[model samples]
Target: MIVETPQLILRPVGTNDVSALVELDSDPAVMRYVSGGAPTPRAVIEDWVVPRAVAELSSRRGGGMWVALDRSNGAFVGWFSLRAPRHGTQPELELTYRLRRAAWGRGLATEGSQTLMRVAFDAPDTGRVFASTMAVNSASRRVMEKSGMRLTALHLGDNAETDGYERGEVEYELRRSDWESARFVWAVRGSTSELTA
Candidate 1:
């Protein structure tokens, strides 16, 4: 296991996960926020996505990609990712997650994200962790906020495939310094809720 939360186990995405990944990408509701509501092709999962995930894990350029599993029953729940900055290796990284429809509305996103945030900030070289989503993807936006990220920017782009192209995409960020300060307070308060309060 790469990282384990109370209810979830994060493991590296491996070549054997192609079928599970295909099952995930084949759900319309799960793919709604991605791929313009179309299920990703199985060939795409086998030939492209799986290879990339495997390579990312092997490179360890950053946290790489992970598969989320239920701790109790050992079922596949979803996947989460922490990747290096788009341009190059840097102290900043990107956070992302996707879940099986069955896992929706269960607070698993926030839980897994909180775990990732802790890992990200714990690294001495990490300066910030960031995430982005379509402006209309309120569910994902809420996850970012609950994970302690603040809205940082909105980028207008050619996201014609998404519903809210006019409003563009939204970026959320949490600096290591801000997380450290809040963590200290949480330690003192002896409650996780105090971090948000």
Candidate 2:
């Protein structure tokens, strides 16, 4: 396990998790922002997503997708990731999360993301942590904001999955130095011990 919270367990995802992943991606709403509204097919999950996820977990030094499990019942809630962009060699990492519809409206996304950011910034050589989403994805934007990220950029792209992309996409970022400073302040204030996310 990479990290554990009062309500969730974050662990490296493996081949055995294929079924759970397929089910999650099969939901139209879950894949809305990613595929422009198309549910990911099972063959793609088995042939591409699963293998790529497993390889990334094994090779990435500071990040990978983690399966989120409910602490009480051990159900697969969803998955979260902190890693470099798919086609880039930059050291910067991107934060991402996708949960089942049943898990929406809860704070699980923020909780898991906070844990990953800690891991990211604490690694001595780590750089900035970033996250991006469609401008209309207010729920995800809130999670990034609550985790201490701020607006960094606006990227215009061709997203035909839905008309929502007409508003463009937004990126949020947090530097390691800033996060470290905040950690120091929380430590001095003795609030670190009480922090949940």
Per-residue lDDT tens digits for candidate 1, residues 1-197, read 38887788999888788889888888888887786678888888788777776776565445677899999899999899887765766688789999999999988899889888876665577789999988889999999999889999998869677666667889999998889887878888787542332
Worst 10 residues of 1 by lDDT: 188-197
For model 1, what is the alpha-carbon lDDT of residue 90?
Answer: 64
- Against the true structure, candidate 2 has what lDDT? 0.83
For every model shown, what is its TM-score relative to the native structure?
Answer: 0.89, 0.92
lDDT by residue (tens digit), candidate 2, 82-162 = 776788776788889999999998899888888888877755666889999999999999999988889999988786657
Model 1, position 143, has a per-residue lDDT of 96
**Model 2 clash pairs?**
none
TM-score of 1: 0.89
Against the true structure, whose TM-score is highest?
2
Give candidate 2 regions above 4 Å deviation: 193-197
